[model samples]
Target: MALLDNGVWSKRFFSGGWTDSALDHPVVEPATGDLLGMVGLATAEDVNRAAARAAEAQRDWAAASPQRRAAVLRRAGELFTEHAAEIEDWLVREAGSVRAKAGFEVGLALGECFECAALPTHPQGEVLTSEDARWSLSRRRPAGVVSVIAPFNFPLILGLRSVAPALALGNAVLLKPDPRTAVSGGVVIARVFEEAGLPPGVLHLLPGDASVGQAVVEAPEVRVVSFTGSTPVGRAIGEQAGRLLKRAHLELGGNNALVVLPGADVHKAASAGAFGSYLHQGQICMTTGRHIVHESLLEEYTAALAAKAEALPVGDPAREDVALGPLIDRRQLERVHAIVTESVAAGATVAAGGEVSGSGYRATVLSGLSTDMPAWREEIFGPVAPVLGFSTVEEAARIVNDCEYGLSVGILGDVGTAMKLADRIDSGKVHINEQTVSDEPNAPFGGVKASGTGSRFGGAAANIDAFTETQWVTVRPDIADYPF
Candidate 1:
């Protein structure tokens, strides 16, 4: 099934529709190393054009009645569900996501759309009593044009998480999807909004690389920039947006840790750890990269986790029985293998699968890892989990918070102890008795410290503030009584 028109993808989507560019890049299916299609690459001029057109559309979209906007968004959500099957297939091929991962991403994205639809009608302003005979209120207004740069991992969900809210809040959006998964990330998104009767020029889609992304960020027409990707690139985008004095909401890299406290069910914690560490081949930013177990339970927990990891079926994503799929490309595969190799050489022992097999790597588990190792400190973004031992709750908290990235953490233990330790951890989110790979449409999701820029997205009220600016308004009926 060809995803693009005549097997060719468009680089631009404006008020008019999809437009092809002269320069295009090939998109390869990672599972079979097959050519899926070609995605048009956006140039600097294309980014500027997209921004200008989005700005033009923002005027009308922002002026539309809240009910009208909400209606359109609700329709879009319905359309997304209607086309879930096709979108899931695209996601599997274009992003190398397995069946479960693809389904979760699409489902979450659909929920985001529906959730954002209600945002238009939600209370956006507040009234406050003033000391003088003046009524003070604050109104939330759209930030005009927003630039969304999404990563390859969970592209659809991440893209729509910001895009849907921006649209509902009366902001025109210019989305620059990662070129690798343009079909799932950019094309499918534009199709849903178009079919839902969104007016032209309101939502623009551009598929491109870093240069094109930089163009969108630097463009004066784009009032806000929201990005989800690696920390290095996010830092560059944030710095540029800061220099330009533009609003930037960033969800970046994460080295999330999953902790198993003493007296916790070893079997249950192992199952959750296995799922969190290897889901989507550990491509998710919130994937459990480090497994911190109480020293009392380390041996048993590692044994159970190793058995689970070794038993997971790894093969092509298209296969129904395969639990794990290929990496996005050979480079990622090599990087993952290198991390495993280096960690093992640095006194870490591989407790489970470690070798690269076929198009994917084995679900590898390493034990006896120190904080000095790169595998423990860096964002692996792979199916490798390094297990570390801690004796006390304080020690566990220290291990979890020692990492530079503080996106999320998973704790499995007594509820009271878990909550107490969670409070001590420096992450933005903590999941007790659950894995780190969790998300909800109504939950405020983002990271802290090096993981992100401390901006939250996903909740109804929070999204409005993220995509819009607040203006304090005060009405004084007796202006003549003032000092003037």
Candidate 2:
């Protein structure tokens, strides 16, 4: 099952054809702890070279016709579609994703590519009113080079969400995926665009750690940065980007809530909450960390959710037919377990699976949650769900709004009442009759406050805003007399 053979990517380096670096980072399979292969480690100097090359190649790429740019993206989508099985294998072995999650991530990535392909044909500028007799226009221009720093969870979708759009809009990209998932997240991307006929240096996937990411952001040639990770890391990146006067689209951590309002079916609401909390082992940023249920339904909802969590099969996804897979690494496993233990210490009662199984955690549910509990306050990026009870609708809204992280929220109830309640919840996305773990390729996908830089990545409007810079131009047939 070793995949780094000569038939596939055999280079010491990941992409952009840099193979002379002697430094190497081992690509380990998370589930089985086997060495997949060795990828060349990138230095800050390599980042500088890559950025300079990207800047150099971006000029010609931006100058190409829109149809040509659109065609390249379309072809990339086709390549993703054709290589779905191979890519999913890499995801399973590299990122420890279950088959279904891996397949869904690839499908979403292809959808993102197709959606971005239309950016080239979309209107790039707008006519503006001019007080003077001259014509005024607002034109959209590429941001030169964009730096994309994606996390290990949902690597493919997160990486492609920003990469494809920036490339489609004529901006060069320097992607730095988490080293834990370098092959599936970064290497596969380079291969797709390379086969799609993207010019050399237009895209470079450099798999490295935090320092490499910092170098990518600090590169003089890079204009915009798109980051998806924790809030603490995001704050540092945002601070640095602010100092450099570069725009950073930061999608950070979340303690999103799944509120079961009155009149909703307790079983159905529990099903939604279970899916939100346990999907992909709850490693997603939008995972439902807190379940706020009506006091009358709290007991029933908690029991139903615990039953679902107890039934889910957890194992090495590459080897078994399972619902949940191993955590990405030891660090994540420790962090998740620590949060669960701390919450239990804080008087939370474990209702379901609480122990670790092999390299992964079992689906866990906790009741009697307090707002001050670690499981309730912190973003536990694991299959751990904490339940809280509220007496009234206002109380439910208060519980949902109490969290400082406002990424996404779910309210299970009538559409009319849910719409009214959604207005009260200060989140970037709200799901009615659905879970917080949801995404649409064409919808605006981002968060407010601690969640992210607020509705920055999604449909054409947001993508254009993130990857392009607006320039106001005025034209005069003749030169006017100067005041001087």
Candidate 3:
């Protein structure tokens, strides 16, 4: 698992069957600082090459029978499930994921692939009414070339959510996964498609940094761009894609809220809140960034959440049995801790776990947050749960709706009340009694406002809009010329 080139993957790190780039970056395991492997660093020119090759291969792929495309996608899912253990190990070492988190990501990726396999046979077009005596219809065609840019956190799932559907719908993809997690996010996908007998050049995996991604969005062959990362980066990509007149489906950052209503079971609500905020070291986009509780349960809920944080374990996920793993790198650790410190300095209280634990920050709970503190206002992206107390249900909803990013929100308490309050929030995903960290293959997942471009990425209906284009055609027994 420490090396990139096993029997499963050939060419070490380059699996696109293209000429290897001279520049490369060493993938280092952050928990132990061990050298994992080397990944290619692609350039702007490499992006053009990949786009051109994908364009060439996409024509025949779109013309291929639907059964052929379905078979390839289904086989890829099977391969992923069969090698789940090995892939989990890679995720642990390369992406700093705990065993449980790694397993969840692999399962999600497999399910996404399986779901997309059924997309090829799904209805493609519909009949249209014509004003004249003619047969009229609309046809769904591939977008030609799709560019998928993924981030390091939850890389495999994010990358495949778009990659599988685009490929299944007859569109070629140029995948630009974050260089830090190239093996798990980029190479693994390329290898799986290769093993599944995807035609050469149809799926190009380019592991690189931001510059190559910019090139991918600007490529002439690319008709659409799907990006999942921070809000700032998604914004930049959206601007660039807008200038190019391309569709950019972005799933960006979230300062999501987990609200605990007045009548909820304190212990149960605290458990859900803890999991939502601290899962995977709070690296997920839908992590409960804000914990809004009714004033009646604030004391008990915060104490219970802090106790859970104090009791949990954290360490090297690859070597030890722990509930949480290290942050992706030192940069992440610094960013997380800085926010906690700044918030505490601004009159917030650290209920539990405010210290640095090796390469990670311990699961932290900040109480007495004034809603203006950084820990409560900003997207910490760490295992820090900031609690804000509210007096009324209307006030709680207002607190939840105050964030700039509207990605996901979770409300616990009375189901009727929760459902009623859900109508007031503007997030993309809402969980009535569950936490914010959740997803399903059949669900349309995306965000609104600063979180994304108000477009979704999962489910058949959403995928059709994301990966394909529509054209109208009319036939009337030869060309009965009109308005000439």
Candidate 4:
């Protein structure tokens, strides 16, 4: 097996230091049955040290002028563009994302850096001078150490997006990347930040699995915990954060619903769903796992969607022609397969894709879905689509809103009606005449209800809160009220 080790950066170069070894996990290439590498694990002590270093660094880094801080972020953006192809290759090899998806993710990361760089220039402070010689001013200050926990699906972009805003806003960061894709993606990030001249101890990369994450969250030095992962895991992190009383920002699993109206373009909706649902093997949290198709077009839409799923070419993710690929690992593949198979056995129709080979499973489509079925209730993080037919818009809305998970939902109909219904959906994001993959960095992306807490990638207001705290200043000057 190839041995991929942790990469730590300091003073514009790799520190040649290693995180404390707590064991190791094997990284595997799912399609070829080849072992990619093994990564050294990090213990609770390592987390504590990283967090303390970040806190210590934040004092000086936050003192820098906004323009100076933004310059570093902007420099990182340029570096990302210069190494786009190299970054994309790492993404494909490590995360098993299709070439196109990996490219898109890289571009998104570059754009996010530019967005975050511009955040500091926004006029924040307010100064007031009164006849009574009273003065007041308010400003935002960095929150010191922040611990970032990333998911494997979009390892590079999702994780670094949080890191960018936190760092650009003057907060030092300790990033705990997902073990599945940590080697290539997280290492690339560390290298780029070092090249951009980030100060030592300001940014640290911790490579490990779930236990490492728990250590980071429990550390007192870690003032903030920003996590992206499954809903259950997010909940666990939230509970731990509550016990520690540290700020927690979570982006969790989404069983996104798509409503196809009677007058909708059944062909268009089916095609969109087929491509959207199976992207990254449907490991994406915002993927459309549940379909609420109109009863009138149920047969036609279901058949069309099944055909689309069958037509998709699944192979190695590194190839440009391959449209779909295997799930990240055996555990994920087994979990997703079990959910679909059990749903079918519980009276849900298996419209397509019931076979599995090795870690690769066929892109599946299920029709005649009942609310009681596992496919309907669970967030099957795989390329399986279960569709329930609805008679009217109200019925579709009811079915879509019934779920406790509501991160995103799509409306497949005339733009006017879709927009109207989008307002009622109990989800963090709504797509009109589009799929769930259409995410904009300027818009706030997150969930409602049990999906998650707080938000990411909206604008300065949404992200500023992630890394900064407000300070209130007041001066009496010469005259003061004597009410007290």
What is the C-alpha lDDT profile of model 2 across 1-484, one tens digit per residue?
4222433554344446545555667889989899988766677877888999899999999999998999999998998999999899988988888999999999998999999999998998999998898999999999999999999999888999999999999999999988888788887888788878888889987776678889999999999999999999999999999999999999999999998888889989988998899989899999999999888888988999999999999999999999899998889899999988988898999999888898999999999878998989999899999999999778888899898899999999878878888888889899999999999789999888899899888899999999999999999999977899
Task: Give one digit per residue, the lDDT tens place, for model 4 in 341-429.
Answer: 79878888777886775556788999877898888898888898888888867788889899988898888888887877777789988
TM-score of each: 0.97, 0.97, 0.97, 0.93
| Candidate 3 error regions (>4 Å) | 1-18, 481-484
Give me the overall lDDT of model 1: 0.88
Model 2 RMSD in angstroms: 1.7
lDDT of 3 by residue, 1-484 (tens): 3223544333243435745566788888989889977777778888888889899999999999999999999999998988889889999999999999999999999999999999999998999998898999998999999999999999899899999999999999999999888889988898888888899889988777678888999999999999999999988999999998999999999999999999999999989988998899999999999999999999999999999999889899999999889999999999999999998899999999998899988999999888788898888899999998999889988898888989999999999999889999998989999999998877999888888876578889999889999999888887787796
Candidate 1 to truth, TM: 0.97
lDDT of 1 by residue, 47-131 (tens): 8887888888899999999999999999988977888888898888888889988999889988988999898899989998889
RMSD of each: 1.7, 1.7, 1.7, 3.2
Candidate 4: what lDDT? 0.79
lDDT of each: 0.88, 0.89, 0.89, 0.79
Of the pair 3 and 4, which is ahead by lDDT?
3
